[model samples]
Target: MGFRVRSPQDFWGGIVLIIIALIAIWASRDLAGMRGFAFGPGTAPRLFAGLLAFCGALVALVGLLQDGPKIGAYAIRGPLFIVAAILTFALAVRPLGLVFATYVTFLVSIMASKEMRLIESVIAAAAMTAFCVGLFTYLLGLPFQLWPPFMY
Candidate 1:
């Protein structure tokens, strides 16, 4: 945490959070009034907004008091094959549907694991995919396609 924020621009994260909090407050404003007087629709938003402003201000204050000279730059540098494997599930889902996506995601996730063996990967992927299909399709009845369906 070496980075020093000199201006609001440098500390733009808090601004974004504040804006989001404000919007949530505004959106929920008409629902109810303050918590103590729950008599009107404006109560809920006012109470929520007040809490949001409080937390946002607290975060901003902490940012201002922290040390300077940001040390490490953050990045995601996982293997390209790993990423491709994950994307494979997404690609398969539209054409192959939920059953395929679940199976592919399982396969990709197993391959993505650092120490996975090929045989174990296959078994684990199959088991996980089956469990997911059962839970989502049978138990939850989410209305997702189990097999590829004709699209117009």
Candidate 2:
């Protein structure tokens, strides 16, 4: 019998999780671990990475055991928009500041929705911007600039 992935979602999800866990584990290799039973900087991250890898393997096993539906067409728009939104937020945060960056990110992410409404998106962006500014700057006292440096 030809081997096949019973559940495409579970199999692919497991693979992604495993990859992320491996990367995390590798990246945290330099961090110090337990010293005389006291947890060090790498302890928690290593533990979490191990757990992620275990969960991914479990998911893959379950996928292999179960007979599932065929894989459907992948939707690129949602993922693309979400990734773009995240990148935009990262790039804009230092230059445009938190409020504008958050607003722009929210606006860009809304484009992923098929039923996106302009007014709703704008309102959502504004609300998100306000919430981020208030939480990070005012409430948490993060010292993030509300506007661009040139605007100061």
Candidate 3:
């Protein structure tokens, strides 16, 4: 008898996770890991990536053992907007600063959701932007521009 995937969705999901984990691991490989007794910058990412790979394997194993629903068609809207938001943040963060970039990113990401409320999104985005500003600036002591250079 041919081996068949009992749970197509879980199997596919697990495969996707594994792919992501592998990408993460590959991405972090160049960074420093354990430096003798001290943990380096890449330690957490490498560890987490390994853990994710293990979890993905387990999920795929479960998929092989258990029955599941068939995989459905992929949605484009959410992923498209999410990618757009990431690109927006990356492009906007430098010239626009954190506040405007973050707010715009949030707004763009919210457009992907069907149940998004404009007022709530605005309020939430504002609060998150303020929190990030405070956290990165005051607590972390990282120098970040709150507004564009032209504005100041």
Candidate 4:
């Protein structure tokens, strides 16, 4: 009813975000040795992580200053599923390659959406996968394996 989050869940959410941001910033700090130009791999993460951490801390401060809600009101569902899916994707990437992993992730996401029919979702995922694979592999010449030699 108000122009604000309805519960304390959001404040705690800010805390979680701050933790994630701190972790990213900490991880990136180890890459300080890569002192390259804007093209360095560490450059973007360092900047991004620092920004995230700063924003997260600011959110926490604002929550503290205001009569913010608490974390207990939030609902967390299917966290295990999300974590498992992420782990699965990481494990599958090298062997199944980018294209296949993309397809699989798309399909899993669509099915997990709980709003689409299985066949319809599969078709849509396949189309999107084809489009992405075509763009990255054929058009941009980004070298990534879609499937192993025998599977392709």
* Top model number, lDDT: 3
- Badly placed stretches (over 4 Å) of model 4 are 1-66, 70-85, 149-152
* Backbone clash count for every predicted candidate, in the order shown: 14, 0, 0, 2
lDDT of each: 0.70, 0.90, 0.93, 0.71
**Model 1, range 1-152, lDDT digits (tens) per residue?**
67556444324556666887888877875575555645577665666777877777766666667644443454343365567777887798888888778777776666555677988877877888789888988999888888888642
Shift of residue 16 alpha carbon in model 1, Å = 4.0
Q: Mark the regions of model 3 whose C-alpha exceeds 4 Å error after superposition.
A: 1-71
- TM-score per candidate, chains pooled: 0.51, 0.59, 0.55, 0.52
Give the better candidate number (2 or 4) by lDDT. 2
lDDT for 38 (candidate 3):
95
Candidate 1: minimum summed lDDT over ten consecutive residues — where? 69-78
Ranking by lDDT: 3, 2, 4, 1
lDDT (0-100) at residue 139 of candidate 2? 94
Q: What is the lDDT of residue 91 in candidate 2?
A: 98
lDDT of 3 by residue, 25-95 (tens): 99998999799999999999989999999999999999999999888888999999999999999999999
Summarize candidate 4's per-residue lDDT along 13-44 as a digit string, tens digits.
Answer: 67788789778877777564455454566677
